[model samples]
Target chain A: MSVDTETVRRIAHLARIAVKEEALEPMTGELNTILGWVEQLGEVNTDGVEPMTSVVDAKLRWRQDEVTDGNYPERVTGSAPDGDDGFFTVPKVVE
Target chain B: MTEFTKLTMAEARDGLKAKDFTSVELTEAHVSAMEAARVLNCFVTETAERALMQAQKSDEKLQSGTGGPMEGLPLAIKDLFCTDGVQTTASSHILEGFVPRYESTVSSNLWRDGAVMLGKTNLDEFAMGSSNETSYFGNVINPYRRPGDETPLVPGGSSGGSSAAVAARLALGATGTDTGGSIRQPAAFTGIVGIKPTYGRCSRWGIVAFASSLDQAGPMTRTVQDAAIMLGSMAGYDPKDSTSVDRPVPDYEKALTGDVKGLKIGVPKEYRVDGMPSEIEALWQRGIDWLKDAGAEIVDISLPHTKYALPAYYIVAPAEASSNLARYDGVKYGLRHDGKDIVEMYEQTRAAGFGAEVQRRVMIGTYVLSAGYYDAYYLKAQKVRSLIAGDFKSVFEKVDAILTPTTPSAAFGAGEKSDDPLSMYLNDVFTVTGNLAGLPGISVPAGVDGQGLPLGLQVVGKPFDEEMVLRVADVIEKAAGPQAAPQEWWKA
Candidate 1:
């Protein structure tokens, strides 16, 4: 399936990456070119195949439901763009 | 001092042990070399001071006979790995100046083994380009230029800077990550040795996320022996990374027994694509003859799913990239572009921060995973991925390893293929299948093109069989003789 300008705009929104209105048309063309190229996979017969969830054969290891680490709020919030007292501060959401 | 910069990691290790030179002296030589080579745009941040400090400490340990395996060995790090307190940008504006409070597990492993940091090298933004052109810092110029031509060429990416640094002897070796031929392709273009160990062989804990299932860290170096030595330190079980396999790390250098006798090597016929230069074809034949002469039986094999590997990679990789990159929302860290509300702020920040290639990928990823198209694009691609992996599983039952050309062509001019995304993606044509299969693959510089640019031959081995891969690569490297070093044009 190919994408148009409107679909490109919608995808940019879903991805939370702002694409200006003028840029959408060219993006739509580029996406369509890639999508068109990948269309060759449709010829393959995948009727009984399973979607690959993991590449390696190892099973996920289970662990006890306990906190092994984490107490340094300062380290966790150290790189925050806007922080106050080791707390991440974001734009107000409540109206 | 220049002689110190010319020594390989193994040579440097021995010299340090014999008291031939101190770590500070070795690191100082590389620091000076790096300063001279800045015109190539290799490093994102050169940590000359930190390197000298670490080297001084290494000298103390060496004097006490307490140095680790990689003691006092200076190496360049791809910006993808978070070096504690050192800027780890992944060569993208989104992560500019984002230093980590803690170190990445792989890098921490290196430091624990006494490796000194020269600096962080640049890469394609978010590890997303074939050529290094997408790096926000600037493109890394290929140290090798065409004969009698002054036009610049790319080093290949997202491990391009690592390849350039090692190729130019600016560093003993450098760390590289391969999601879709990032390490191997660059190594091939730059005429060096690069290996991507089996998935889970190296911990992905600290390397910036780029298609988690496909990304694995390895070494880019001037020699196969050095690659083997470095991979030994880099690969191990890390409990921090949930996907990291709980297995023993082997002495990879020991695997370089340089014997390929009685080993059955498969040459996948599907790798020969349309428009492949005659020089590349000739190089492939030379590689086959070298292996055969080394007492190995060469068999023709068919990975029928090989053609589908690249296309399937585009889908799976971007889908994962979109999800992995979602964390950069301008709220937590790095660059922030303010907007009226939180959502708009995230939009503005990401749009402003990510490079063009990254934006296109995230959009494609979002579209494919959207409600109406998930099964058609994402699921189909994953199913095809299973087929690609299955092809390798079946082939490994017949042969110990597979030998193929590392890339379709030699290094091209910087802007040659960047305009067309599909054409750019085609560079990974021969190497992407290994990632899909989660196998160990290494690119050994085998021959040069007509233009005098180096090309590589790849050895792909079964799951967790990097030893066999290294063995075969060592045989090929021996057959090819030492690659002629790229001229030191940057050293005016």
Candidate 2:
């Protein structure tokens, strides 16, 4: 299962990583190499085997549905690349 | 009277308790060593001021006879763990200067027990690469070079900086996170001790997630006993991490009674991979003989799925990484490259922020989990992971622990395998199984290769049974005596 240049572009888009037209071919080759190597897993007969959901068999711990921590907006956005009045500011998504 | 930097954590703890040296003096020694070894690029940021301040506080506690277990002990943190007010980059350009508002549970636990920070050490960006070359900061030079060769070698990564730091004695011990073989491989490369405890043994709360299931924080130290002591302080349950096991962390140091009598140690034939160097094979034989001489019953075992671990790791780790790193868009934090719109901005920012290796992984991850390929790739890999874990489960029922070579070979020159990702990935072939099974494993520097480079032997134990792992590793350390430390070539 090799990924073509178009698939690389598609996945790169899906991954939110921009790839130049000239670089797509090399990117495709790199992805295909890794993908091809991982293809060896196909040889393992996984019939009736359950896919691992949890590495450790522990039940999820339940807690009361209340705010245990937070209320510091400044701290929340302290490292924001772009912020306006303690809210993360991004390009206009609407309109 | 001794070089304070030469003291191990245990020795320093005793020396401080006996009033032989203050924490500040010990910290100063390490700070000086770190300065001298700056050319190795082991640290992304050096927190000498903060470390000194913390050490001063520890000295006060020591004066009052209230020092915590790790009080005044300066340790390096892998940048993957969040340190409050200290930049944690995971050695990525994207997070070049990102500081967390809160500390990671593991590091916070260390500080709670009196450990002082020596700043964040470099790692493969997001813990992605086998060689430190992928670090945005720069590749960490393994302090151990081939005999008299001046050519720089890679400290096995993505915990390369932490491994190199500990190996170079820049810090008494450093924190390392192993997802696949990040911790063990580097430790093996640098001829030190590193242990990745059971998956939930250490809290993952504030750790920058790579492969959520596989990533575990552990210790990289000069000796197995130090790894044991550090692991005791590092392991605990945290409510923030839902997966954290609600069990009492054992006195791991006490478990190092050096008793392997009548214990069953498995030698999986599958680990003797094709083209493994003669020295590594001989080292494995010596390790087995050492154990056998110590009254350990060495049993031949077959973990057929052992060969599939690295390949399976590539699928699971990146899939989780793609999801985890999705949070790194333009608005949140770190580097941001502006684009026309939100989507374009994310694309540009990520493209510019992540390095080639990281980009390649994210791409592979995106491809595997994308539409139509999820079942064929992601799900299949997970099933293979289960089979790998199952193999260990069955083997552990018979053997107390398993012994194998930590890495396929000793440290290779920088750029030797960087061009070939698969070849670099093969470095973790022996170490990844422990991560897949969520078991504790430790690497002990047992011998040197023909190049006079260090090699390590590994002991993988049952789930949450780090005590047994430490016990076996301690025996190996005693048998190996002491491997040669790298000459201080980086000193100006």
**Number of the predicted model whose lDDT against the real structure is largest:** 1
Tens-digit lDDT track of model 1 for B362-409: 988888899999999999999999999999998889999999999999
Q: Distance (Å) between predicted and true CA of B491, model 2?
A: 1.8
User: In candidate 2, which residue pairs get closer than 3 Å at backbone N, Cα or C atoms, i.e. clash?
Assistant: none
* Per-residue lDDT of model 1, residues A45-93, tens digit only: 9999998999899998887889998999988888887867989988889
Off by over 4 Å in 1: none
Residue B319 error for model 2, in Å? 0.8
Q: Pick the candidate with the highest DockQ.
A: 2
What DockQ values do the models have?
A: 0.89, 0.91
For model 2, residues B1-492, the per-residue Cα lDDT tens digits are 789888999999999888898999999999999999989999999999999999999999999999999989999999999999999898989998899999999999899999989878999989988889998898899998887689999999999999999999999999999998999999999999999999999999999999899999999999988998899999999989989999998888899898899999999999999998889899999999999999999999999998889889999988988989999997888999999999999999999999998888888888889889899999999999999999988888899999999998899999899899999999999988888889899999999998899999999999999999999999999999978888987884
lDDT (C-alpha) at residue B339 in model 1: 93
Which whole-number lDDT from 0 to 100 does residue B158 have in model 1? 85
